[model samples]
Every structure is written in structure tokens, then in C-alpha cells.
Target: MIISFVQTKGGTGKSTLALSTAFSNHMNSAFGSVALVELDPQGTLRNWWNERTELGRDTGRVSFHHISSSQKEVFADGIKAIATHNDLIVMDIPGESTGKLHTRFACAVSDLVIIPMRTSTNDEAAFADNLYPIIKEILKVDPGKKGCFYVLPSFTHPKANRDTIMGYFTDILPPHVGCLRTIYPDRSVYENFNREGATLADYAYSVRENKRHSKQALSAAGDVEEIARAITQMLEKEHVSAKKEEATLRG
Candidate 1:
């Protein structure tokens, strides 16, 4: 499974989500092993992986690569090679539309493309103004794509009007565009833990040592696990369905 997490606007937690999913799968052996690709010029994910490695964390099962290229052909070739060698590749690209054809190529090869946005007014407005057209372009450029796009609501708060916001988003979302059932809440633990170059799954501290943090820590960990599991299962279903379609067509 090749997965790409993208958003046109910055600060939508796209990098964090990509890293979390990759680490969660790596630590859990979620997809046997995983490759983490950093295509973003910002190199945020690369820095985090380096810090984590320097902290003596084991990244044996996780392969990390930072490819700094904007040329469409180079990026397309890079993605093709990565997809060939790795069963799963999670790519974090630049959070802007001008990153060029690499973004569209990534979407073309991906098993799933996650477009995360916060529930804030700015994010909503940006998603409305920019995202759909980008998706439209991807379909035009990569017309043979077998993958689909999903809108992920990130950094949602309980105090906000989530239902109303989601309903509006759903109403406007075009066909084949879906929403993720799991919403990533704006939690301090997610920020604080990752700031120290540790994933929630690999936090190293005992889940039971701190009584006050026990439930919250475990719940946060569960959120990552749920996402990893959901993504893996979705890929499996697609593979199975694809194989069946191939068999029917051959018959």
C-alpha cells in the first residue's frame, strides 16, 4: 500500500498525521514493514526521524528517505521505485499546490490519499477554495488512478460545532470524495510527545506509571492504532476486490 498525506494549506497537521501513521504501522508491524518518505522541502519529518534515531530509538523496521526534488519526471520515477520495493510507503509532501506534478503523481500511485484539514474557519475556507480543484486536476492528469481521496478533520475540539461543520463539508464534497470517521483532536500530548521526537506508540514510558496520564495517554495511543488498523484493512479490501475484478475480466 502506497499512501500519501497532502493538503494545500500549511499547518493542517499533514506531516504529523503521515509520521504518526507510518510509525504506528512500523512499531506495530502493521504492514510488515514501512517506508517513510519525505518529499517536502521543509524536511520536518526528516528532522523528527533524526531526533528520534539520536535518542537511541529503534527504527530498524522503518526505512526513511528524504527526496528533495520538484521535477515532475524525477518525482514520478522516485515514487515508482519506492512503490516497487516497499509494500507500504507513506509520503509527506510540501503543503502547497505549487509543489507541481509530483503531488498528482503521488495521488495516482497511492492506495489512499489523505487530505487533512482543521475545523477552523481558515482551514474550511481554504479547503473550499483550493482542495476540490486540486482533486479535479489530479483526476485529469492521472486519469488511470485507482485510488480515492478522503477529507480528514484534524485538530477538532469538543467545544466547536463539529456536527454542523461536518455536515456542511459533506454536502459540498463531490462524488468519490469521502470523510474519515476518525477525527484527530488537538491534544497537548500529541504535540508535547512528538516535540521530543517520540511517537505515541513508542513513548517508552509505562502506560500505567502515571496515574493521571494513564487514560489520556492510552486513548491517544488508541487513536493512532485505530487509524493504522483502518488504513491497513481498507487496503486489504481494495486488493481483494481488485483481484476479484481481474479474475472476472479474465474469465
Candidate 2:
């Protein structure tokens, strides 16, 4: 399965969420091999991946790929090559500054396109003015992509009600766009977790001696694990539905 974390507006936690999800235990166990692909030319993840390498950290089942090309053909060919060897591909797309080129391509190719948005006026407006149009265009071309686009509520208050946040997105989401049942809560841990190219798990381990910091780190990790589980479940269900449709057609 191929999943892309895409948002037209920057500072929406796209890169962080994409990396954390790829590193999550659920995703690692669900797929044999996973590829973390960065479509951003700015190289936010490229720098981080380099740090991981320099530090000699183990990547385990995840491999990193950076494709800075804006050409659709190049993107297609490169991702296809990566997909051939990997069970799952998690992509981090660039923001609106790229002319929405990467945004449109990622939405078109990904099995699931996750848009991380905070519950705020600016985010809602950005989606309406920028991202949703591309989503609409894709759905116009292929109606089967309906459930492929999901809105992940990001930077939500840690103590906020999940149902309330989910309902907010549900009420405002355009046709064919669905909302994830989980939220990426705002926590101090997220801001500091990636120091020295550390993963959330690594951060948690390092802060184990400090009770407050350790608790925050664990909670943030739990949030990522839940999101990963939700994504895998969605893909598995889609696979079953596709098989059923195929059998029905044959019958």
C-alpha cells in the first residue's frame, strides 16, 4: 500500500506525522518492507535521514528515498520502482509553494492521502482554496478514490474530545473526503522528540528517567501507533472489498 502525507499549507505537521507513522510499530509489523519517500525538494526529511545515518541508527524495516523532481513521469517511475520492492510506501509531499504540483501528484497516486489540518480558520480556508480543489479534480477523474483521502486532525489539544474534533471535520469535509477517527495531540514531546534525528521511540527511551517527560513521550508515541493502526485497518478493508468485487464480477 502507498500512503502520502500531503497538505497545501505548511506547518501542519505533515513531515513529522509521515515520519512518525512510518516508524510506528503497527506499520512495521503490518508490512514486510516499508519505504519512506520524500517528495519535497526542500529536504526536511533528507537532512533528518542523513543525521540518522551519521549517528549510525538502525532503520530496521524502513528505507528512505528522496525524489526532488517535479515531473509527473519522474515521480511515477521512481515511486513505481520503490513500490516494486516494498510492501508499503509512505510519502511526505511538499506544500503550496511547489505550485501544488507535488500535492496533486501524491493525491492521484497514493492509495491513501492523509491531510493533516488543525481545527482552525486558516487551515479550513487553505483546504477550501487549495487542497480540496485537487481532491475534487482527482475524484472527478476517478470516483473510486472516494475513501482514499482522509483528514487527520493535527495539533489538537491533548485533552480535547476526539468525537468533537472528528465531528467538526465531518461536518465541513467536502464530498468524497473523510476524516480519521484519531487526532495528533499537541504535546511538548513532539517539538523536542526529533533532536539529533531521534525517532519518537528513541526520544521516549532517552527521557525515561524523567517522569513528566517520559509520560508525554509515551502518550505521543501512543497517538502515532493508533494512527498507524487505523491506516492499516483502512487499507486491509479496502483490499477485502476489492477482492469481493473481483469475485462478484467473475461470478
Candidate 3:
């Protein structure tokens, strides 16, 4: 399956969520192998993978391959090449309006396109002005494939007013976009993971050895697991829906 985690605005945890989902799927063997495609020019996800590999070589653990490309043709070719070998491909897109075409192409080709947004007025406004328009264009190009798009609430503060924030999207987001039950809390584990070049899934065993620190870390990890499961379920349901659509067309 091809899953692209994207957002037009930066600092919304797009790369982190993309890498974390890819890592979680890889570790769980949910897919025989997973490819993390970094389309961001800043190369955040690419750098993270490189650092993880270096750490893994020193510590003896699995590391992910980072595919980097900014050109749309190059990006498409890279995705095609990686998909040949991996069961699941997760893409991290650049955060800007210039990449909207590429992002739309990825969304059109992907089995699932997850748009991660933070629960803030600014973030919500950006989504409404920028990301939502691009998503609408993507849907215009592939109307029959509307079920593949989803909006995930990420980096939400535990104490934030959820109703007041999410209420704005009531009339905006498409019906195909599922409301994720799991909301990723704004925590230090994400920062630590980015700084340490390790994912929560990557540090699970170590968390078991440390009690106090691991308590919060483990809780965050549980939240991540819930997010991953929610995504997996969505993908599975999309797969079934696609199969039924194909059958109906055949009939």
C-alpha cells in the first residue's frame, strides 16, 4: 500500500508521523518491508533515517532507507523503484505551495493520503486556505478515489479545547476523511525522538528497562500505536472498498 503523510504547513509533525508510521509498520512486520520516501527539500526525514542507520550500526538494530528527490519525475521514479521491493511505501512531502502539484500526484497515486494537522487556529486556517484547496483539486482529478484521503489531528495539547477547534472543519473536510480517534499529544518524546534519531517503536525495549522516564515514554508510545492501528484499519477498509468498486464496474 502507498501512504503519503502530508501537510502544506510545516512544523505540524508530518515528517515525524510519516517516519514513525513507517517504522512502526516495519517493526511489526505489518508489511514485509516499508520504504520511506522523503520528498521534502529540507530532508528532515532523510536526515533522521541516516542518523538512525548510523546509530543502528553502532548499536545493532534495523534502520530504514531514505529516498530523496525533489523533481516530480525523479520522485515518481523513486517511488516506483521502492514499491517494487517494499510491501508498504510511506511518503513525506515538502511543506509549501510550490509542491502542491507533486503532493496532489502523490495523493492521486497513493492508496491513502493522511493530512496531519495541529489543533490550533493558525494551523486550521492554513489547512482551510491551502491544504483543503489542494485536496479538492486532487479529488477533482480522482473523484472515484475519494475514500483514500484522511485528516489526522496531530500535536494536540491535552488541555486544548477540542470542540471549539475542530468545530470549524464541520463544513469543510470531505466525507471520505475519517475522524481519527487517536490524537497525538504535544509531548517531549517527539522532540526527543527527533533529536535522538530514534522512534518510539525503536526505543520500546529500552523504555522497559527505565521505569520513571519510560512511564511517559510508554504512554506516548501507546498513543502512537493507537494512531497506527487507526491508520491500518482505514487502509484495510479502503482496500475492501476499492475491490468492491472494481467488481461493480466489471458487472
Candidate 4:
């Protein structure tokens, strides 16, 4: 699966979603592998991978790459080569539509595109004015692409007016837009995941740092599991559909 976490609205936590999804998928699989392609110039994911190595942790079936602008075509070629050998490749990218680097290619090739937004007026407006246009443009470019598109609500307030946020999404985007079943609350566990250089799946089994019983880690573990399951279902469905289409063509 080639999953890309993207948004045109900056600071909406696209990197967080990409890391969480990538590593969660990594730590759970018995034999499946994950490769994280960091297209974001900030290099947050690249830095965290370094931290994980310094901690003497098993980077286990996971690799990180920081792609520079001068080498986008090379980066794209590398990602395609990796995809053939890996079970998952999660691409983390900046939240901007117009960039000098080659992001339109990334948008075209993703198997799944995730857009994260916070529950606020600014984010709501951005989804309408920015993210929606980006998605629309991608479809225009690749009208026959088979991919899943999602908008995830991130950094949700505990006391947030849930209905109002839901209403805004329903109003701005068309109805029946699929959202991740779980919302990422503003939690310290997510903050500490990379700070601790571990995924929530790792945290669930991390008895060394008392992460196994850490209340914050424990709470977030369920969220990660549910999201992973959702991702798995989507990927499987897409594969099955593709196989059927191919079989029909032969018939």
C-alpha cells in the first residue's frame, strides 16, 4: 500500500498521522514490512528515526528516507522500487499545493490520501478552500485511479462541540465523506510517541520504559489498533476490487 498523508492547510498534523499509521502497521505485522518516505523538508520523521537508532531500539522492518528537492525524480523512482518489495510505504509531505518540488506526482501515485484537520474555524475553512481543491485536481489528472481519500479530525478538544464540527464537514464537503472512525485527541502520548522514538504499537509492548502500563500509552493504543484495522480493511477491499477488474478484462 502506498499511503500519502497530505493537506494544504499547514500545521494540521499530517506528519503525525503518517508516522502513526506507518509505525503502527510496522510493529503489528509478524512478517509485513514498512518503509516511510519523508517528503517533508522539516525532516521530523527522519530526525525521529535517528532518535530510535540512538536508543538501540530495533528499527525492525522499517526504513526512513529524507528526499531533497533536487532529487525528486530520483526519490519517486526509489519509492516505486521500494513499493514492489515492501508491504507498506507511507509518504509524509508538506501541506502546500504550490511548491517547487514535485508533489503533484506524489498526489497522483498514492493508493490512499489522508487529510487531517483540527476542529476549528480555520481548519474548516481550509478544507473547503484548499484540501478539497487539491483532491479535485488529483482526480482531474488521474480520473481512473483507484484510491481512497479521507479527512481525519486531529487534535480534538475533549469538550469540543462534536455536532458543530460534524455539521461543518457535512456542509462544506458533500455528505458520505469517509472519516477515520477514531479521532486523534490532543494527547501527550502522541506527543511522546516520537519523543520517545516509538510507535503506539511499540508502546503497547514497551515494558522497558513502563510504557506497557503507562496510562497515556494504554489509552492511545486502542486508537492506533482501530485505525490500523480500518486501514487494513480499505487496502484489502481495494485489492479484491482490482483483481475482479483484471479477471473481467481476461473474460
Which of 3 and 4 is ahead in lDDT? 3
TM-score of 3: 0.86
Query: Cα RMSD for candidate 1?
Result: 3.0
Off by over 4 Å in 3: 25-27, 57-70, 159-172, 202-210
Give stretches of model 4 more than 4 Å off: 25-27, 70-72, 97-103, 158-168, 174-177, 201-213, 245-251
Q: Mind sharing the TM-score for model 2?
A: 0.97
Q: All candidates' TM-scores? A: 0.84, 0.97, 0.86, 0.81
> Under the 3 Å rule for N, CA and C atoms, how many clashes does model 4 have?
0
Give the per-residue lDDT digits (tens) of candidate 1, residues 157-214. 7345657657866876676677766667777667666765777666636456776666
What's the lDDT for residue 174 in model 1? 73
Give the alpha-carbon lDDT of every model: 0.72, 0.91, 0.71, 0.69
Arrange candidates by lDDT, highest first: which order? 2, 1, 3, 4
User: What are the runs in model 2 whose C-alpha is more than 4 Å off?
Assistant: 248-251
64-167 in candidate 2: lDDT tens per residue? 99998868999999999999999999999988887888998999998888889999989999999999989999999987787888898999998899999988
Candidate 2 all-Cα RMSD: 1.2
| Model 4 Cα lDDT, one tens digit per residue, 164-234 | 66665556654324565556667766766666577766766664467445767767766666666766776
Model 1 reaches what TM-score against the true structure? 0.84
Q: Model 3 over residues 187-209: C-alpha lDDT tens digits?
A: 87777755557777556556777
